[model samples]
Target: MQNEINIPIILASVRKIGDAFLKQYKQNTIPQSMDELLKQLEDIDVLCLTSLKKDLTATFFHMPWHIGDEFDTESQKESTIKGDYWLCDAMDGAIQYLQHIPGWTINLAFIRDGKPLFSVIYDPLATEMFWAKEGAGAYMNGKPLMVSKKTDLGVMLSVFEYGHQDKSTNQLNKEIGMTVTRLLDNFGIVRNYGPHGLQLAYVGAGRIDLFIQEDIDTYNWIAGMLIAKESGAEILNADGIPWQWGSESLLVARKSITEKYLEIKSLK
Candidate 1:
C-alpha cells in the first residue's frame, strides 16, 4: 500500500537518458558501490531516487548468491581491495556483510548495460549530494559544474585508491600503474583514497584538473560525467579509446586538460 514509485516507469526514464548519452558519447558512466549507496538511506527522497534503495539491500540478500564478477582484476588484490565485495573468493563473505551493512552508506545509480544513465550520491556526514542525467548534465546541491581546462600534465593533480600494496592479480595494479605512470610522467601529481564519488566530483567541478581511475563501473561514472560534460569536460579510455558504453577503465578531466595531458602522456 506504499503507492510510491513505479519501478518500470522510473527505470524506463533512466534508460531513455542513458540512450541519449550513448548516442552522443557512446558509453555510460560507472556506478557507486552498494554499501556506499546503502549508507545514505535517510536521504533517499532528497536525491529524488526510488524506493529501490531499501529493496536493493534486501534483494541482494534473498538473491541466493552475490555477484563477485562485478569487479574486474584491479579490485581483486588483497592490497587494492577495500571492500569484501572486490575479492573473487569472498562472494559468500560479501553477501553476509551486505546483510548487516548500515543504511547510511548507500550510493544509487541507473546504468545501461555497462554505462550510467542516471545517478544520485548521498553523503550524510558531509551532507553533500550529487546526481546526474546523461545529456541533461551533472549537478551538486542543485548547482551546475564543469571540469578544469588546464593541460599542463605536470601541473595536473591525480588520484588512485588502494592499489599500491598488493598486485597478487597484477591486473588492477598494472592498469593503474600504466595510467598513473602516464599521469605522473606527464601530469606529475597524484593522490589516493579509499572511497570514490567526492574525488570524481572535484575533477568535474574543476577543483582538481585531472583524475585517472583503473576500476570504474556504470554507477561511479554517470553523475560525474554529467558534471564534466555540462562543464565542457571530456572523458576517455586511457588507451586512447573514445570512451565506449561499457568501458571499465575510464579517464576523466577538463577538455583542455585532457587533450594536453593525453598528448604528454601519449594516451590518445
Candidate 2:
C-alpha cells in the first residue's frame, strides 16, 4: 500500500478491534490453552487486518498481503514486502493470560519506512486504551500521557523481570535478581506484575518511574516503544542503542534517571 490512510481512521479501527477482543477476554470466552488463546486473538487480528485492508485498498487502490496477516517466524523472515507493514501482538502477555492474570494487553502498530507511525496498547481489564500518532503525542483514555520527571533512581518504583522461577540457566533472570538486590540497597525495588506491555505503558503514563528487561520479542515491545517515545520517555537497549523495532533488550525511564542508571551500570 501507499500509506494514504488518515491517522484518525487508523486509530478508530484499532479501537474497534481492541474493544471487540476485550469483550471476549472479559466474557471469558477464549479458551485457556496457548494455542487456543492465540487462535482467538488471531481472529481479532483478522478483523483489524480486514479493516485496514478495506480502507487502504478502497482509498489507495493497493494492499500488501505481507502485512495483511500474522504469520510464524519463518514466514515473517521470508516475507516479500519490505516496507510499510502492520505489526500486532494480539495477546501481549500470553503467560499472564494463561494463568488468569490481569496485566495482559492488546498491542497494534503500523510501521512505515522502518519506524512506528501509529500504535495502541489496550488493557481490557482496566478499560484503558493508550495510543499515539507520530509527532502528535500519546494519550490514555482521552487524556495525554507523559513520562515521569523524576530524576532520582532512589525512591523510584522500577519494574524488572518477573516470573522467572529458574535462576540456574536463565542469564537474564539471574541478572534481574542481582539488579533487584542492588536497587533495594539503593532505596528502590523491582515490582513485577508480569506484563512488559503494561509496564511500558505504565512508564509512559507516569504510573511507574522505570522499566528494564534483558530479552523481549518485537511484538511485545513495538507498540510500547511508540507509546513510551510519544509520551516523552527515554528508551534504550542493554547495549545503549536507541530502542527500535528489532531490539532484544529494553530500558525505559525518564531521561535523567536513564543516564544515571547507565552510568552506574558502566561502573560494574
The C-alpha local distance difference test score for the whole of candidate 1 amounts to 0.48
Which segments of candidate 1 are over 4 A away from where they belong?
1-105, 112-115, 161-172, 215-219
Candidate lDDT values, in order: 0.48, 0.68
Q: lDDT of candidate 2 vs native? A: 0.68
Q: In candidate 2, what are the lDDT values of residues 164-231, reduced to their tens digit?
A: 23336658676766667655665365587676777888889998887877665445666877888889
Model 2 misplacement above 4 A? 26-81, 162-170
Top-scoring candidate (lDDT): 2
Q: After superposition, how far is residue 138 of candidate 1 from its true place, in Å?
A: 1.7
lDDT score, residue 254, model 1? 66
Error of 2 at 232 (Å): 1.6
Native-structure RMSD, model 2: 4.2
Candidate 2: give the clashing pairs: none
Each candidate structure's TM-score, on Cα atoms with residue i matched to residue i, is 0.56, 0.77
